[model samples]
Target: MNQFVRIQYVFIVALFAVVVAVSGCRSSTKTYSPEDVVHYDESYDASDKKKIVRDLVDPLVQDTFPLARQTEKPILVVYGISNRTSEHISTDGITDDIRMELLKSGKYSFVNETQRANIEKELNYQYSGNVDPSTRLQKAKQLGAEYMLTGTLRSIEKKQPRQVRLQKKTLKYYSLNIELTNIETSLIEWADKVEIVRESSKPFIGW
Candidate 1:
């Protein structure tokens, strides 16, 4: 009888422990869904800018360069792209996208800023030593680039309130200008401008 009672007690304890362990292991995971509404008044989509630069600006510049008889493997000099806007925009990203496309087209070569700086430093160091003066000038001429490319980005914003509701609309207009200048002749061989606009609507959600 005592043996049977002991077995029953052990079984009951084991069953209780199992129940506690199973309940302790219970857990749930949740995933959040993005809001269906859009917010913010001013935002520039970087991806869109990259796509536009590659698709529109690169071909135009390539065509212009070929027309100018600058068929040689011209080394690219990135002059400047001024951002005349209120927002902090990375004009370099856009220029880089265009540069990559230009490189893939195999029509030109680029002198990156770092490479140019290193070349200049080495040239200076060589000239400072016992190297002949004529040899320095010859090397400089050999590495001299044929042309420079430059551009600017400008933005114009206009905001208007809707007539029927408490909502406002913002229009952002961006103008991109590019120019190719001949380094030997100091002449602008080609120039072009492209403009794009994006609009966003803001609703008065009580936040």
Candidate 2:
């Protein structure tokens, strides 16, 4: 009986040891770093558009906000971007990129028009309960935007296909037009455009 009990204890100890060893082996650490570069292809992906906006559009917009170096940081509102392209591109994503770049430059303050409804809902919810009366937000106290940013994304495509050779070539040109308008004065403070052209060749198989 003693020998049987000793054997059971040994087996349980061995199993626990194995479990600990496996758990230790499974533990790992991962490191993260900033991306060094990005490549653009024919596919209509967000990365390519973001790169274009970052590299080209950002600089043009920076030039427009030269007055940022002055004493005050201007307040601006993004009216959202329009997608007039054949491809189902992410116009809202592009608008976010533009807003991010502009904000990162420390040149302007932004009033998020897109989130206004959500903000109103939250304020209403807070007013219902769980919010301190003294610290509660007031809708009438909201800051007005001094300037508005608006834009459109457009694309032009040219395609040529040779049935005999089973070869096809396509050229796609994308253009982004943006404007900064003074809200009170109803004047365009700045405007510019950035364009990108992509060409691709592929074969039509078994047609």
Best by lDDT: 2
Q: Residue 121 deviation, candidate 1, in Å?
A: 5.0
Residue ranges of candidate 1 with Cα displaced over 4 Å? 1-42, 58-71, 120-142, 161-164
Give candidate 2's TM-score: 0.73
Name the lDDT value of residue 155 in candidate 1: 87
Candidate 2's residue-wise lDDT over 1-207, tens digit each?
A: 699999999999999889877774457875433343343445566556666567644554455456566567888898977989898877888778778887887777899898899999999987997899889887677889999989988889988754566667888888888888999999997887878788877767631
List the candidate 2 regions with Cα displacement exceeding 4 Å: 1-41, 60-64, 161-163
How big is the RMSD of model 1? 13.6
Candidate 2 clashing pairs? none
